[model samples]
Target: MRGYVAMTAQEVAEFMASGLFDVSDVYAPTSQFIVDHQDLDDEEIEYTLSMVAAEDALEMKTATSGAACVLAFEVPAESISESHDMSISLSSPLKWESLECLFEVSSDGEELTWYATQEIDANLASWLK
Candidate 1:
């Protein structure tokens, strides 16, 4: 965690232009493990997932086949306040996972809040982990 080089968007954009943050690699879905970080408890994972990727500005993948996929987001806009919009998708090849989000991040980058129907598989138990 301490090794990551966090930079301002301007610096990041410059690096991106220079191929520092390879866009393809940055977003590539992988199981090719980096530092297999210690497992984070459900409560420790702070996230906002209320919208769909196809419809909402942001979307969260529902858990499937016991695996979950969600978007790692950044609030880059300035006009949004209180609440905004998003689109959540619950899709997976696993067939057992249903990804759900507790809420959404406001456009202005406030804390998390969400819509009502943002759960993947309600039947999935807490014992799976």
Candidate 2:
């Protein structure tokens, strides 16, 4: 197979939770950080999440910076309809670099979007390293 695969929100959530991306170094510390500081408001929390997401994305991009990878985000919605909703794009040039794989975490925590190239989709595990 050699095309984009559109995964459902549940599929994305499951993939994200499957430890496929080796994000331990990227996101495992937030719990301790939050536990250490108990007075963060909504804005602070949101900002922290955004920063973490951005850093993770940058790390991925940096790894594939010069490779055959192209990472991008696809925006289905032009504007933010809710304050706590966000969408992120994670892409790479390998065999699946042509389309956008969206990672969306909605404010209600009820939705997610993820896609990938069929040929190298399973290779994300190795790539994240």
| TM-score of every candidate relative to the true structure | 0.23, 0.27
Cα lDDT over the full model 2? 0.34
Top of the candidates by TM-score = 2
Candidate 1 residue-pair clash tally: 19
For residue 126, model 1's alpha carbon misses the true position, in angstroms, by 34
RMSD of each candidate? 18.2, 15.0
- Model 1: what TM-score? 0.23
Q: Per-residue lDDT tens digits of candidate 2, residues 22-85?
A: 1111221234455654687655654454444544443334332311222222222321122222
Displacement of the residue 4 alpha carbon in candidate 2, Å = 23
Worst 10 residues of 1 by lDDT: 90-99
